[model samples]
Target: MPADTARGRLPGFFYRFAHPALAVVSTVGSLLWLAGFALAGAGVALRASDPTTAYALFYYGSLVSLAGIAGIAAVVAYLVVLWLLRDVLDVLDWEKPEPGARR
Candidate 1:
């Protein structure tokens, strides 16, 4: 046998850092998206006073919300896939490269 030539798993702290950072990033991204919702709400609420301005604000706010949500979802999905892949690699002893090889 080749003695399972893979290197040892990454430290728990490293995994912790990766996961928490991803989560924080996801949350911040989502909050950025929610800001669009707030802006839209403000625009609608103010429409009674200024229809033209409020209409423009609402359109921009909706666009921002859509873009923000899409971006956040993409990022979160990517991170989740990486996290899952890491777990699978750990389970299968695939995280580390072959023996005697650079990472």
Candidate 2:
């Protein structure tokens, strides 16, 4: 039987929901990282005009960039875990006979 038609429904449900949710999170993280780069650039420009304010902007921008990196790493780690689960499921399903496979 196909993977989706397996007796246990939990794996199917997780495969359906988790993939898209992770994709959304990864996309948002990438956007945040890009925004951080822009902020850093603005901070550089401000450095020439106002040294004190520029320092604050640079500090906060670095923080934002670090957060973005963390988010991306988390998403990647989760995806790897999901892939491992999928492989395990595939192995189990392969070993088990389908509904009417046996004579």
TM-score of each: 0.56, 0.64
The residue-by-residue lDDT of candidate 2 on 4-74, one tens digit each, is 65566645554555366776577678888887888888889999999888888888888888888888999
Name the top TM-score candidate.
Answer: 2
Off by over 4 Å in 2: 1-18, 88-103
What TM-score would you give candidate 1 relative to the actual structure? 0.56
Model 1 spans with C-alpha error above 4 angstroms? 1-18, 83-103
- Residue pairs in steric clash, candidate 2? none
Least accurate 10 contiguous residues by lDDT in model 1: 5-14
Reference-based lDDT, each prediction: 0.71, 0.74
Residue range 1-103, candidate 1, lDDT tens digits: 3344334233333355635565555566677679888888889998999888888888888887887787678777886677687775554344555788754
Number of clashes found in candidate 2: 0
lDDT score, candidate 2, position 34: 83
